[model samples]
Target: MRQAPSERGIDPHLHRDITELIEGLEFEHQEQERATAEVSWYKEHTLFFSLV
Candidate 1:
Protein backbone atom coordinates (compact mmCIF):
# COMPACT_ATOMS: atom_id res chain seq x y z
CA MET A 1 0.00 0.00 0.00
CA ARG A 2 2.88 2.34 0.75
CA GLN A 3 4.12 1.94 -2.82
CA ALA A 4 0.84 3.01 -4.34
CA PRO A 5 0.77 5.79 -6.90
CA SER A 6 -0.68 8.20 -4.39
CA GLU A 7 2.13 7.44 -2.01
CA ARG A 8 5.00 7.19 -4.49
CA GLY A 9 4.99 10.90 -5.38
CA ILE A 10 2.97 10.35 -8.52
CA ASP A 11 0.80 13.15 -9.86
CA PRO A 12 -2.31 13.64 -7.77
CA HIS A 13 -4.47 13.63 -10.89
CA LEU A 14 -3.23 10.15 -11.84
CA HIS A 15 -3.53 8.72 -8.34
CA ARG A 16 -7.30 8.49 -8.66
CA ASP A 17 -6.96 6.04 -11.54
CA ILE A 18 -4.89 3.51 -9.62
CA THR A 19 -7.87 1.52 -8.47
CA GLU A 20 -9.08 1.09 -12.04
CA LEU A 21 -5.64 0.04 -13.17
CA ILE A 22 -5.35 -2.54 -10.40
CA GLU A 23 -8.76 -3.98 -11.29
CA GLY A 24 -7.88 -4.22 -14.96
CA LEU A 25 -4.61 -5.95 -14.18
CA GLU A 26 -6.31 -8.38 -11.84
CA PHE A 27 -8.86 -9.33 -14.49
CA GLU A 28 -6.18 -9.90 -17.09
CA HIS A 29 -4.11 -12.00 -14.69
CA GLN A 30 -7.09 -14.17 -13.79
CA GLU A 31 -7.87 -14.76 -17.45
CA GLN A 32 -4.33 -15.80 -18.16
CA GLU A 33 -4.29 -18.16 -15.16
CA ARG A 34 -7.55 -19.76 -16.25
CA ALA A 35 -6.16 -20.36 -19.72
CA THR A 36 -3.02 -21.92 -18.33
CA ALA A 37 -4.98 -24.27 -16.10
CA GLU A 38 -7.12 -25.37 -19.06
CA VAL A 39 -4.02 -26.15 -21.06
CA SER A 40 -2.56 -28.22 -18.25
CA TRP A 41 -5.78 -30.21 -17.93
CA TYR A 42 -5.78 -30.87 -21.65
CA LYS A 43 -2.19 -32.09 -21.59
CA GLU A 44 -3.01 -34.63 -18.84
CA HIS A 45 -5.91 -36.17 -20.76
CA THR A 46 -6.10 -38.27 -23.90
CA LEU A 47 -7.85 -37.18 -27.08
CA PHE A 48 -8.55 -40.76 -28.20
CA PHE A 49 -9.05 -44.10 -26.46
CA SER A 50 -10.15 -47.71 -27.05
CA LEU A 51 -13.01 -49.43 -25.17
CA VAL A 52 -11.47 -52.88 -25.40
Candidate 2:
Protein backbone atom coordinates (compact mmCIF):
# COMPACT_ATOMS: atom_id res chain seq x y z
CA MET A 1 0.00 0.00 0.00
CA ARG A 2 3.08 2.26 0.01
CA GLN A 3 3.61 4.91 -2.67
CA ALA A 4 6.45 7.40 -3.38
CA PRO A 5 10.14 7.29 -2.47
CA SER A 6 9.58 8.37 1.11
CA GLU A 7 7.44 5.32 1.63
CA ARG A 8 8.94 2.05 2.85
CA GLY A 9 10.50 -0.31 0.23
CA ILE A 10 10.14 2.14 -2.67
CA ASP A 11 12.79 2.04 -5.42
CA PRO A 12 14.50 5.34 -6.21
CA HIS A 13 14.36 4.76 -9.96
CA LEU A 14 10.69 3.99 -9.82
CA HIS A 15 10.07 7.13 -7.82
CA ARG A 16 12.01 9.23 -10.31
CA ASP A 17 10.07 7.74 -13.21
CA ILE A 18 6.78 8.38 -11.53
CA THR A 19 7.77 11.95 -10.71
CA GLU A 20 8.78 12.59 -14.31
CA LEU A 21 5.54 11.13 -15.61
CA ILE A 22 3.49 13.26 -13.27
CA GLU A 23 5.40 16.38 -14.23
CA GLY A 24 4.91 15.65 -17.91
CA LEU A 25 1.23 15.14 -17.43
CA GLU A 26 0.95 18.38 -15.47
CA PHE A 27 2.77 20.30 -18.18
CA GLU A 28 0.47 18.85 -20.81
CA HIS A 29 -2.57 19.78 -18.78
CA GLN A 30 -1.40 23.37 -18.40
CA GLU A 31 -0.81 23.63 -22.13
CA GLN A 32 -4.27 22.31 -22.85
CA GLU A 33 -5.85 24.75 -20.43
CA ARG A 34 -4.01 27.67 -22.02
CA ALA A 35 -5.11 26.61 -25.49
CA THR A 36 -8.70 26.27 -24.37
CA ALA A 37 -8.67 29.71 -22.79
CA GLU A 38 -7.23 31.22 -25.93
CA VAL A 39 -9.91 29.58 -28.05
CA SER A 40 -12.63 30.77 -25.71
CA TRP A 41 -11.31 34.33 -25.78
CA TYR A 42 -11.16 34.28 -29.58
CA LYS A 43 -14.70 32.99 -29.83
CA GLU A 44 -16.02 35.64 -27.48
CA HIS A 45 -14.27 38.44 -29.36
CA THR A 46 -15.42 37.12 -32.71
CA LEU A 47 -19.00 37.01 -31.53
CA PHE A 48 -18.86 40.50 -30.05
CA PHE A 49 -17.42 41.95 -33.26
CA SER A 50 -20.01 40.17 -35.37
CA LEU A 51 -22.77 41.75 -33.28
CA VAL A 52 -21.25 45.25 -33.45
Q: In model 1, where do residues sit more than 4 Å from their true spots?
A: 1-13, 39-52
Best by lDDT: 2
Model 2 RMSD vs true structure:
11.5
For model 2, the run of ten residues with the poorest summed lDDT: 43-52
Best by TM-score: 2
lDDT of each: 0.63, 0.65
lDDT tens digits by residue: candidate 2, 1-52: 6577566666889989999899977976666666668765543224221121
Count backbone clashes in candidate 1: 0
RMSD per model, one decimal: 13.3, 11.5
Give residue 39's lDDT in candidate 1 (0 to 100).
65
